[model samples]
Target: MAPTAHSAVIAALRAVGVAPDAYGPTLNTAQSPRDVDVVGEGLAGEIRAVAAPAALVVWDTSDEAVLAHVVARNLDIGVLRAFEVEGLLRVSPDVPAGAPVALLATQWGERRLAGLRTLVANRGGQTVAVAAALTSPALAAVTDVPTAALASSDEVTGVPS
Candidate 1:
């Protein structure tokens, strides 16, 4: 199996003697609503930010409502249960309503650009990836890394490049 972009990033960080501890939860702006810090009627309220990824349907056996949202601001990904609005300011890194945000299942598809629509520019010196999904939006923008190569390739890259 090929090394994941996350693994590769970690390896590079280690090569430079950068401790993973540097980021830790500090780098984690996108947090789960169940984390206590976030408490509200819904994921948006829990996140305390608007447009923080919504209604992410997942495949689970129990069939209980499980949704995963991303903090488009800091590349933070999280899952939560569905609920009503908590009434807060729209401050998260999520794309605005009707901004053509695609709720994908983390699988690369023809609409890669739509996925990139969710990413917000880094704020407060946050470390964020070019694509919110990391390499899916990058698949089209794939380039050589040492001798690494993409299994399959396309140019329908998403996000603001």
Candidate 2:
């Protein structure tokens, strides 16, 4: 049987020496209804600032809800569309140089990462991949740089929502 998402996330975190439970119960409370909206807004703002004329590729339906919320805000930055990985790969849209491309996912998996890499290679743009959990593996896979390097690099910054 396949491991559940929760288990997979926990295992991924543990593989990188992150004790999932090290934070204890204080970090395990229920999320508020507005949490997704808040996160989405921040992410949307970041994407808009850097890559206004960008495409948003979402990996899961849950993420699409965030996309919808982002769209409803009518930020007027540019055309923001959500595509499945396969569809985006097939479409292979043209991305202008220096424009930002964003991938939104609640979890990271091999297939999704591979697709994002391919899309970036084919489209040619600054890449930003955001995962709801932001595990170490996810960060490394998205950046193709050592996590330590990312920690020191001014180019990459993470704000926890």
Score every model by TM-score: 0.20, 0.44
List per-candidate RMSD values in Å: 15.7, 12.0
Per-residue CA lDDT of candidate 2, range 9-94, in tens?
A: 34332332211221110111123334434434544544454434355544334334444345335445332333455444532345
lDDT of 1 by residue, 1-161 (tens): 22463243333222222112211101122233333122112222222332333323211111112223332222244332212135221223433343322132222333332222222211111111112221244434433211111122121121234
Please give the distance, in angstroms, between residue 56's alpha carbon in candidate 2 and its true position after superposition.
2.8
What do the candidate models score in CA lDDT, each in turn?
0.25, 0.40
> Which residue pairs does candidate 2 place in steric collision?
none
Error of 1 at 16 (Å): 35
In model 1, the Cα lDDT at residue 29 comes to 21
lDDT of 1 at 143: 33
Query: What residue runs in model 1 are displaced by over 4 Å at the alpha carbon?
Result: 1-105, 118-127, 130-161
